[model samples]
Target: MRLSTDSPSINDSKSSNKHNANELAPRPTSIKDTGIQESVLLELMLKHLLSGGVLTKAQLVNKMGITGGIIQELFDKAKGLAWVENRQSSAEGHMRFALSEAGDRYAKQASMKSGYRGLVPVPLAQYSKICRLQSSRRNPITFEMLQNGLKALVLPNDLLHKIGPALNSSRPVLIYGPPGTGKSYLCRNLNATLGDSVLIPYAIAIGTEVIQVYDPQLHHAVDNNNESAQLDLVQGHDPRWIECKRPLRITGGELTAEMLEVQFDSHSRTYMAPIQLKANNGILLLDDLGRQRISAKQLFNRWIIPMEERRDFLSMQSGEHFEIPFELILLFSTNLNPNELVDDAFLRRLGYKIHFDALDEPLYRKIWFQVCEEQGLSCSEEMFQHLVNDYHHLLEKPLIPCYPRDLLGIMGDQISFMELKPVVTKALIAEAWSIYFVQA
Candidate 1:
């Protein structure tokens, strides 16, 4: 995808100046500034021409995510080597080019070396610097910002106060609570508090090894038409880096040890970056912490250094180790007891340990009415009382936040199925409660 010169979200605090200044890596002026060797750039161009067959200069610029001038320089070099030849000019007056017989052979050899045929990658050193710079320049979270970000959710002011400082600290947060208490939902919304956009490269290069960093599934691009036009008038924004909202990535019980490391594809000869690396300058939530495929102790051991030093170590297939800034909010959410999952020593390393409990009657009622409004059903005080007194209190079930939405959803489904008006009746509540909760 092409990069845009989008301004950061205005809600961000003034403390983000450092980040905003260096957020966009200046557009490279030459192949040397690209930080990629000439031979590597040639191979990349050859591979694109080989796969696409007879492409225009504009097409190569778009596919390579580089400036047209750099593409021209590469084209000139290729012409001298007889690896590429000029074709008929396009209707738009753009010069078209195609690979020579020898260029096709060279591209095949390049593919055999590594099949990665996408945007030219940022150098590992440049990427590492950007990660560290953005991490250190994060805007401090305020109580007002936190409250404003999570205004849609029904949460206590005390909890907001606890979370605001923890986020500003930029340290690991341990949120332990019972199931259905909204820990996961709360963590997801925390990204909204970080109002600024971040630059994520499509990929990063360590010598010849390429690691893909940007995932469309995780990073949501922001449009900056006005800013982009202004930037174009002055200096172009680097197409190599995509402007995106701060990413929020979550991994639950299915997480494996292998997922936390760089994955190399033998056939393709390219590397896929781990989740934490993708989550740089953002938040990474380890949901359902204690139930991962790997043991909790093993998981803790794997990240212990990164957690403490704020940098992680990853190795290429060749066993050459490199350091990347572990610049992200690491949030651990679990329904299980923290003590049982890990010893106090590990817990001590965490910045904050916040607890989430069952909601009280007032909070429960507030969420209930909110859900009723959301589901387009009339809220009934009598039916709500019956649900609380008969189902929750009688059955000794705690009033969890998720119960309102779940029970109301079940009732809405039944009403729709039975062709009845959208109303909350005691009988409907009973049926929904029965279906939602198992009876002994």
Candidate 2:
């Protein structure tokens, strides 16, 4: 089922309204509107000048992601303080500015305080407001949407119904089942069902401390080279806020308790937002749930408040506590028994606990044929019957969704290495199966 490119329906008016509300962060006209102290802005400008060496007004504007007026205002302030001097005019009649000795000293001092010289950060209050607004306006996921998004997978309709409601509820979901039953795969593709975008700031400011929020590796920027984006720019859209697809972060066995806290880099002298913070207004999948370095109970305790209250409290290096909106879909997928991981009380708190069991014969065969088609290999009915009756049934191995794709992959690799024709034979299937599973 292909995603419909049709326009949104009338029922999505609330989502449309919220989208409009968060579509753009209005450009700040003055230092007051920037939600940053003038001294801080000046120090940042000085640092930029010291690093970049002789910057034009337009260049500073581009570098700082602010308007030319603000840059000129800072330049005037810096000139008055003897921290900046205007150089001779260029061929384009634009006066270049460089930091004087005193300005250089001030910049070095500022760098000692904090090395953040990137885009001006959004105020923490404003960032929290936008996160809550976007989360509140998420469009309700319909069955049609879920079906279309997951059409490639061989999932049962009953499971889809459960998943659709769980996704719309904006609560924690526990997907537990046997290994390789497509649990993680389903969670990964859930982002495709959103089909919506959110505004992500480059960084956020709390007091004098700066915490970078946008990660180029995690946040994929949406193409904004269209008419609407042009209109937004003309209408004073904030360049510091990037339009991006709803983020999807997945962490498996590598997860640690330290990762849940705000991280500080001594070299950069700036705080890095945690995974949950970056995954706001999107999805965060804790795959391989019980396999983390942290115990299940300890992990549950860490998330207890965030899961129930829908807000997370994080701490800074200076013992300051702040709250951030926990506006994301939390998904936990595990191969272990759910009861073994957490207690009944904890399970009761989850919105939905859906089990992903082994596939029945018909579904398994469908996936097998689908894999065969994808691998460009022909599987005759006789071969298929031989695989099912002799390999799986005789050995009492359950039909798993990943088996077809993985076994075929192994067979394809063997064929390529041996310089044999690309065909699915009983011998090839037997060899792949033997190599795939250990016989007791």
Candidate 3:
């Protein structure tokens, strides 16, 4: 079986293999490769020392993902300042250094200012540069690539044609359709088709303040451990950057305007990069568009300038404003009509407005059989015809793609309860339909 490049198991196995000397060459051998200031390194060193009384130079290198030479250089500087002292010789013949009283006092001050004690953050300038380098525009998705990406889904040929060009437009898409027509599902699958991975920063440093960007919940780290290790041997990536599958984030009715701005965590003395920033190199999907707590007009107006300029302005607590790349595939999914939610001005901003209508009889029947096959239940042509001609046509109920899967699940439950064999019979389906739909 083929494993995805982003699989952690694959990455771990690769990382475990011995690497060639030239391959090892890519690993960060100096502070410059880390893309962090020396002062920040020094502060990080001090903070790390606070954990254990003493640490060998090698330990510091592993903890900080820095080179030995750089760690030694920082250690010498700290020793010169009377911040650290060689406490004892270790079994490996390396001297273990402990923080001096002065160093301990300095570390306390550093901790008070910002409690961040992880791998060093890349400077905002460096992060912005990296973002530009990995910008989504540079890699235009082709129709063939999208076809391969969504090959698993049973998408119609016409819809596939529409999706291909919509993705190429590099503008926000509005997928308006009735509920259960797979608007959100299609957007999600489109994200899967984006192909290669991009690196995302754990956090970014803007002057003294740090904005955390890597969201554990959102960012999926690629496991190509061997490849990453080999890559490091030849040329090291900044430790601050994580190798991740391009993010595809979705927010629904619960979304609010406040979420669009930089969220400052006073307790941590740091900031959380908003959803848009986190989705910089990926797709940002606003599912259920008109249903947000904030009005659809409010959201549309807020995005107008940014969408036009292809850049976003974010502010820190100090009111310092900066422009960040708005390089992402923006998607808006809604069951509500776009005409009702957005006017011509806002509509113009949306590149492709695709509509998903209720499924027709033939497609609905195919999906019914597909669902029955998946559920390990025998498909009955007689029963399927009964549903279409009796339950649906008789009642004037439109065919929804989701009904097969949902009705099948309901039927499965009833079958289990009554201790009957799992099969789609006309009687069984009728009973499930009665339970599924009630008089309003």
Clashes of each: 0, 0, 18
Residue 75's lDDT in candidate 1: 89
> lDDT of all the models against the reference?
0.84, 0.84, 0.77
lDDT of 1 by residue, 1-440 (tens): 11222334453432253235334587777899899988888999999999999898768777877777788889899989999998898888867899999989999999888888888999999998877766623556667767877889999889998988888775699999999999999999988767666788989988877889989999987744122222111343566777778899999998999999999899887789999999999999999998999888999899999998889999988998998989999999999989999999889888799999899999999999998988899967888888899888988999999999999999999999999899999889889888988777
Q: Which window of 10 residues has the lowest lDDT sum in candidate 2?
A: 224-233
* Least well predicted 10-residue stretch by lDDT in candidate 3: 16-25
Model 3 root-mean-square deviation: 4.6
Winning model by TM-score: 2
Candidate 3 shows a clash count of 18
Q: Summarize candidate 2's per-residue lDDT along 94-114 as a digit string, tens digits.
A: 788998999999999999898
Candidate 2 Cα errors over 4 Å, as ranges: 1-24, 224-233
Which regions of candidate 3 fall more than 4 Å away from where they truly are?
1-28, 90-94, 224-235
Better of 1 and 3 by TM-score: 1
- Model 3: per-residue lDDT, tens digit, 1-440? 11232324545533422222113223556677665677788888998998767888767766665666778878888989999988879987878999999999998898777776666677777667667666666656666767778886666778888877887676788888889997887888876676556778778877766788989899987743222222122354544567777899899999999999999777876688989999988899999998899899999888887787778998988999887888788889999878999899899889788888787787888888888989988876887888899888999888988888999999899889999898788778878888889877
For residue 49, what is the lDDT in candidate 2? 94
